[model samples]
Target: MNNISNKIKLRREQLNFSQEYIAEHLGISQPAYVKIEKGVTKLDFERLLKISEILEIDINELLEKQYIVNNFKNSDSSTAIGMVENLHQENQKTNELLIQTLFSQISDLKEENKRLISILEKLSSNK
Candidate 1:
């Protein structure tokens, strides 16, 4: 399993939350939630954010590697926290870039669709 998946499962257990409860909150089936914990289902940013909210912890906690979070009670907690913060920031920037790219692609596709429609209209008029 991915480290993040393990951390999510551990946090859920720590909160004494059942898979069914989380599934209900996420509007997904229990089996689907199970797949998430098992790392069988890929987690998108939105779903990860929702899971973090449902778990009642900072999203960074979920973003952090399991080892780092586990060591938070130790003297290196600051370092661990910093690493998690850096990772979260990087993830946020990457997500922003992906959203921008997707929007650009969508706009291009829309223009192409409009051009195609116009061509079809001209062809019909000629016919």
Candidate 2:
């Protein structure tokens, strides 16, 4: 399991939401909702969406492996810190890739715009 249930519980606590509040939103009993947070019950897509909404988080945030890794704890403090550092490095790489992609897209658009402008200039000069 991904320990998503623990993440849900942590988010709920952070938001100060009671289990009853979540249960009411899900149209289930408090105990049933508790089961969901405790990983005893599997969440369907619809329910997962509802829970994400209630937590004011994106579904991707709830399901992200990075989030799970970030929350991981070990008895050894050094190991836990090392794991977090590794995740941060991975995130930096992902961010760098996204920035590179965006710059490439902007360059492509500028080239296309220049080509269109040149064509328009030629047409106007002929006129």
The local distance difference test score of each candidate is: 0.81, 0.78
> Per-residue lDDT of 1-127 in model 2, one digit per residue for the tens?
2356878998999999999998999899999988898788866555777899999989777765554644555437887778768667755654564566678778999999999999999999999
Query: Best candidate per lDDT, number?
Result: 1
lDDT of 1 by residue, 5-118 (tens): 888899999999999999999999999999999988877667887999999988777765444445667658678778678667756754674586678778999999999999
**Model 1: residues >4 Å from true position, as ranges?**
66-127
In candidate 1, the residue pairs with backbone N, CA or C atoms under 3 Å apart (3 or more residues apart, or in different chains) clash, namely: none
Q: Estimate each model's TM-score.
A: 0.55, 0.52
Q: Candidate 2: which stretches are off by over 4 Å?
A: 67-127
